[model samples]
Target: MVVKTLGKEDLWCGVVGGAALATGGGGAAMPREFFDARVDPLIEKGVKFQIVEPQDIPEDELIFVRLGVGGGIERRMQERCLRRFGVADWIREMDRVFPLPKWAEIPDEEWARVAPYRRLVELKGREPFGFMPFEIGPNVAFEIIRAAMLGKPLIDADNAGYRAVPEVSLGTLNVIHAPITPYVVATSYGDLMVFEKFLSWQRAEDLVRHIAITSGGGCSGMVSFDEDFIKKGTIYGTVSLAMKVGKAILDAREGGDDPVEAILETTGGYRLFEGKVGGTTREGYGAFTWGNIWIKGTGEYAGHTMRIWYKNENQISWIDEEPYVTCPDPFTVVDKKTGLGLSNFRPDHWPVGREVTVWGMKCADLWRTERGLRIYNPKHFGFDIKYVPIEEKVE
Candidate 1:
């Protein structure tokens, strides 16, 4: 019923708020110069950016999940390379070298025949398929831009709410049996690879991660699915949610209000802890930046301690050896003074003794289900504890 047109202000808000929703992952918030350079050019060419509420998306239409597949400085290098060479030119180069599958449209007849409700099985596509992103992030802009180029509309809902994850198969899309294959992976240097067959979500993720590593730091992927399948499975209303969060922060700075309170009030998030970064350690292997960070409480919470575990984004958080907030629910680290997000991608950027605030929010209802817990539970990430929602654990 309510649709939001994405203007310049909305775009800025979305990026900032979406970075918060990213929960310390989803790549760094796009630099203003990058957005103007990359997205503005498209706008000049008549590209329209609009966020459609899930209820408004026609059920029969397809939604493609678009995401970036790599990390580190190398990925940035790859992105710059990709931008230098246009998509058409990149595709041509990919075809010239790798010669993997190119994106193709799937017809209604083939899509309607998804083999009768099988839960966990390989997605055998009789034809080429596509889907749109169900998440928000730095990658989100690219998805929007690509969708505009391809002439399709993106759904307002995303599988992870605004949260970011390390692997492709971890989202509600995979849990809901949404097919991820017939997906295309494109790198900055113009190498392309396609995966049309995967028996399990892990295999799909593993394969994609491997490709990302080989293809330079990361690549872009497009996975198509029926919009109806993701309607109930995703976190709805994120477009408005992101805008509100972004605006809250901006308003705070302009009005001389406390940015931290602004964010907590807007998102219903809790300021779980405040501290200074003691140190951070992370390593890259298999498409994710995996690591842990130590923060020693400062000011009011002085003498307390906290540690967070992350795979691209913050996933497991512990305070004073007590299980704080783990996966499924989102937790993030924000600069204590500015309230801006800090990424795990580069720990050196955060440095030691930087003041930071940790916040936690409840994950989507979809992730609390028994099925959902099995996918993102703390134990799944090798922790011994069960995940308790941030709302339950905080107050």
Candidate 2:
């Protein structure tokens, strides 16, 4: 099996490229501080960050999908929980135990960050062969970090293709009707719940979202033993795609070329709009960041305006009151000058008067299928517009 070892530069590229494809959700790319504090130390200890293609894994190997439910509200909830739990107290107890005993012995503060996989091993009676991220974005680094910590390589695939979505039902695994149960959910504050069965994907989303709201935010691990299901249900090579896109941006900047143009060329995506952020509004409710970003056109788009509506990720965009682009085709808002994707995880990033560019890429072919559209299209998000392929809309 061929495995690609990642260096610091490769991981940075993954973070930036994943953020661009995140379509304004999936949490911010792993921050520099986080990398310096957590990942850097691991690398110093000779921990290798690695990834493997989906087809390279053995047929009988097990893969676990790790994901998180996050929104602006969840961040606030996290702060509240931290204050209530007392961070100093939690830190003091960190060294009180070593190799925590089984399930409940793990501290609440560390369980969500470290125990999901351990819990999975306990339930499965064997170790997972590799780890898979639920989607692209900072989730790339998240899975990489988890895999590195566990001395395993991450699968170079994601269930959400090149973009992140608000609902669990929107994943390609759901699109392919794969079994998603026997999963584990752990909150930041030490709550753990396991679902051995669920009636439907919608029900699972509901449960997870509610728990996220109540507990600030949390991580979830999904187990699958079937190789056929794993191969068919995920969009392969997305991690590599993110790295490519990121490298293009970096190379462009170093070579004094337009990073935005480099991004378009690398992904074959379209420049949907160029302007300055005119205004923005956002609300955190039902475990989602619901908002709109208005951009006042500039240059060739002068005198016009574009508005983007998002439910966690960019869902639909309108230009001068006409529907311009809509999901499940992924679109993102990026800083026009820097070419970095602006994150919806932080509302301040979209402040008024910031120069920006809006770009979009075609969704994976699976998302355009009748079933994929049913779950991801405008109607699913309560919009009346029909789904239009990004390519068609641009043309």
Candidate 3:
């Protein structure tokens, strides 16, 4: 049951941020890189951060949400009828109703423009619930320090999307009117202070992006404070849970155990396909640079392969050329090295000539949810279809 940490040094630097980034509009970005940037410059001028998990976030504390994951908002959410998010029922049991809207989807051109800060950047808060992206190492640490001074709950999981996206407003936050004061915030830094306040999250995001463009790409604010919303809206335990999954794989590898064996012991996920990338297609349209992946079977599953597709940052859907998932029930993605998990990282360009397996992160209950239709299932993410009771087992 014991698992390993994300890296040699667990401390503040963890593996959840990237995955958070990958979650796009689904979850919040892991501010590890951003936090790193703030620790110095902002800390010198007074910035702070606190490490807390979903469970640790005080239910009564006023909070705000932020994004480490953000790229674009879907302009045609209503038109597309996309439902890849958690079931509203399950989500309601976990927390308040904060259904996010797909705002503006990222244009591939603009995406290329913001790619640097998009990955491994620190977002700090200064005002009541302010935030700024910090690329430099020192500023990241400074932001963490400032968050600590806020004396509010900084839950480990991002209540918002993953990655350093366009702006905070792009998320379903403002549209849902979930009362967004509990997330990231920014302050002082002079002109940076103007960024501290905005008429709406949309305005704030627009301002921030403009700042980034003006600054050559992306800009980081010294203050990132969003305590109120933390006390109110946002998903709680998902982030910590994601970190736990990654750590489990890392730990299993360190323990000299077959990571897949360890993962199977941990997640009841199904190994839907084991193959190599046989095909690739990139669809770049307006704000989207989408792609599709094809898996050619090998080993015991020879003659059966799978095909997966995705938008710029998410797994859009899957079509098993073999439909083998009927037996596995769900699909999955595991580390090629340990066969544990592909966490934060997923399959992109195949044909690299490597043995691989695709698993699904499915639970029986997930299949019955409103979003249980084709493409929205756990198999969509290439996760094996199985649910592990880690919450109960670990507890």
Candidate 4:
């Protein structure tokens, strides 16, 4: 078990595979262009990143999971606001209006002396948080950057495995009954609001979404505590898993192998359908994109149809109205040729008649257990069927 360091090359694949793992849910995939514009500068100026295996995490230290919250519809609206208000000036305004807690930079010995005191104040009565991701994405990059800043190790475990769900309650954190309070939400405009308690996952979800909407439709947040509490709850090696999937896709393209096959082979996924985008309709709620998409068959399966229902991530699939695949399992649509994931948020970009491949993979092992199913059963999403694994449902 050797530890691996992730650098420039891995970031590209990490982002690509992490987005695919998001399973058409999660926040919009952070564009490579955006990465170049926003993150490259930080790297150029000496920020570095490395991913440690979860087993390597020191039990004595605290860990935190960080992520972003928002919807595609609101994201679009926020972009318009940014353009009108001016990014630089607006960020400065946000800093003035929403100040974050600041701590002084000091030597390790001095910091160690006060760390327990600081942790005591932060924890109050809450249990320690885990040292992994809730889900991977551009936020993983943000976490890596934060880890670099704090001189802490970023472990490669992620609570959701690779499938991103729409709510905080949908994660391993909730399943394990970990306290998610004492979390911090930092707005794009620089406002930081901390929530020290929540009565329920639903309440926390609503509060986070409300903050995101009012604070310009997006925010970076973190749950911090000691590492011991989340060790069993998290599924390890997910970041490396994403990197492997991404690397396989790139390898396939350059080596003239089938990219889609490469993706399936690398990720142990099965192709559910090969078709064209047929039609789609969506509904926007508090901070989620819920919708159904139709993919009409082509080639060997001509004239057949597949329907997928999504709540951020793809939830259920129907073959001509027959229940096919459902949530707690991953359902993703990718470009047939390039093997790139198509955001459920932008089916319009996928367009009618464009070739796409639908892939299904088992959700994280944690998501398949009794408690996991309790949190993610089809009934939880208002579907009538008892939960079935994707492998069982797919022909």
Candidate 5:
């Protein structure tokens, strides 16, 4: 049923609408508006995407973008920015400092001041928008800043699921276990600014007050990043999917039907666990987004609970407050309203208070064989998972 074609006309632009929903609440913040003549050319030219695999990629070509802000960091940064620089100029100033893919000039000392404020962008992946939410962790301050020293285009492709959570270690590009700098202590005063990077995610989060005061209640700077990883890991189809999920959900919702029903019909109804979010635990730290999605079911499903956790890089399941859904299983937070799922790369604040919804998880073995498997696999996201489809699971 999966058809591949570009500009093939009325061909059902699945990626188009899909890109929009991937953005979560922050989809509106995209630098460029969707459905414009500018983007049409790319769609027409045949731009193929295969999730984020280093192997399938041509070593020479590259693309990248940091999607979503860490938990509440965006809100704090926004508040601090508005207080000091005002809304109009806040985004403007951020743009000035973190211009797209261009080499920017910075004062060595000034860079130090804002180094910990933020890594400029974040990338997280999950089952959202019919594809995985490829993540870009918020790297540490100057210590691990790659793009800053080299300068890179921070592409506008963060079509992640929701938008909170900020653990830098969840990204695939990183080899070391250490997470990207999760905290940024920023200060700005009119044209004067200072920054300090912190290893602590919460401590850095707490500095919003100080930075707002320091930036004269207004802060601005081009966030720094790692240029190489951006090119290597950042997937290309963000915009394409954001716009489509809505219609997809609408159609699924229109038949007065439940998305869960649709999923069961399409995916063969693989049951992993059913419960409400609990414990406040999460997959791991420094994930583009991380939180414990507690699930305790009512009726027969009661007593048994699950921690649908993620590290922004991959998901690890916990049953009855213990880690059970370990590596390679697919875990996602679906929107109760539309029945659409967002990427795990969503910000940490996403799952908080979002009502008790179902968390669907599929394991690696579900997607191993060449022929489609009914079991859950990464490919169910519309991209290739580590394994192949299992007919037994699906059927």
Candidate 6:
């Protein structure tokens, strides 16, 4: 079996490249606090984060998709769950309720990260062979850490291709008509819920989203025992792709080269626009962050303005109020100088004068299919605009 060990540089690559592919959502790149709190502890124990090829996985082994739903009323949800369960501290209370001898020494935060996966194992009566991220984001670190904690490697693949999507229906598994249930969800305040079956992927999305709304946020674990199903339902080598993109950007920056040029070369993407942040409008509703960014052009693109609309992830862009690029074509805004992808979560990052570059790339072949466009297109997001490939729009 061929295995690749992910070093500190590789992990940082995942953070940077994952954020770039995140399209303005998918949580921020791994923060210093996260590295200190989670990654450092594992390294001190001699645990190496490893990525194994999909073909290397044993036929008998089961793989679980790890997903987290963000954007919720955290403080309110905490109060509600705590009051309902009569516990002052959720993790401490959970230890008292569903004690695990094997996890007795695990820190509370670490235990919370793996709780959903542990619950899945208990329900299935089978330990997972490895874990795969449902998408790319900060969760890339979480998945790697979870797999290492469970003495397993993370498969070099992702369910949401190279970028993160806003809803469950956007996952590759859904595109392939894979069943999502026989899943387990673990909320922040120690609530564990299991779904033995679900009516449909759409309904499952609604249910899980509501749970996230009520619980403030939570992680869900779903398993697939069929190797064939996994192979067909996931995009392979995306983890390596993320690392490659990140390394190229980092290398260019250190060499006193143009990071934007490095990004375009690394991803075969286009420089859609270069400008200063003109303004932005964002709102949090229905457990999702929705917003738009306005960029006043600069340099060669002077006098032209660009607008991007996003529901967690960038969905569409318009140049001078005319459709330019629309989803399932992945696009992002990044700091031109640092080459780091910016997140919508930080309004300050896009202040009026912040110079940035808008980069657009052709999405994976999966998203180009009719079925893929039906769910991911601008029309699906309530925009009347039709889906157009980025290459067609730019070239």
**Number of the top lDDT candidate:** 2
The CA lDDT of each predicted structure is 0.69, 0.81, 0.37, 0.71, 0.35, 0.78
In what order do the candidates fall by lDDT, top score first?
2, 6, 4, 1, 3, 5
Compose the digit string of candidate 4's lDDT tens values, residues 1-395. 34566677687787677666667865455667886786678678877677777676666556666645766345555643352364456544445665534651212213322343245446555433224667865356555655665555568887787777777778876777777877676655434566778997667877888776665555557676456655777878888888888788878888988888988898889889999999888776555777888999988767789999888778888888888888888878888887777777775556888898998788888787788888887898888977778888765
Evaluated against the true structure, the overall lDDT of model 4 is 0.71
lDDT of 6 by residue, 1-395 (tens): 89888887688777777777778888887675666676777888999889998877877678888765765344555454443443336546656776646644533444445677778788778887788888876557667877887788999988777788888788777777888777777665555778888887767778888887765444444555456667787889888888888888889889999888987888788999999999999876666878899999999989999999988888889999999998888889999898888888777778888899999888778777777777678887889997778888988
- The list of candidate 1 runs beyond 4 A from truth reads 1-3, 72-131, 187-191
Which of the two, 3 or 4, has more lDDT?
4
Q: What C-alpha lDDT, on a 0 to 100 scale, does residue 104 get in candidate 3? A: 21
Q: Worst lDDT window (10 residues) for model 1?
A: 111-120
- Tens digits of per-residue lDDT for model 1, 85-115: 5545654655666564646322232221122
Top candidate on TM-score is 2
How does model 1 fare in lDDT? 0.69
Error of 4 at 184 (Å): 2.1
| Candidate 2 local lDDT, 18-41, one digit each (tens) | 888899988886667776687778
- Model 2, which residues run further than 4 Å from truth? 30-33, 74-108, 217-221
Candidate achieving higher lDDT, 1 or 3: 1
Sorted by TM-score (best first), the order is: 2, 6, 4, 1, 3, 5
As a whole number from 0 to 100, the lDDT of residue 57 in candidate 5 is 33
Worst 10 residues of 5 by lDDT: 136-145
Candidate 5 or 2, higher TM-score: 2
Alpha-carbon runs more than 4 Å astray in model 6: 32-37, 72-112, 217-225
TM-score of each: 0.82, 0.91, 0.49, 0.83, 0.41, 0.89
Q: In angstroms, how far off is 4's CA in candidate 2?
A: 1.1
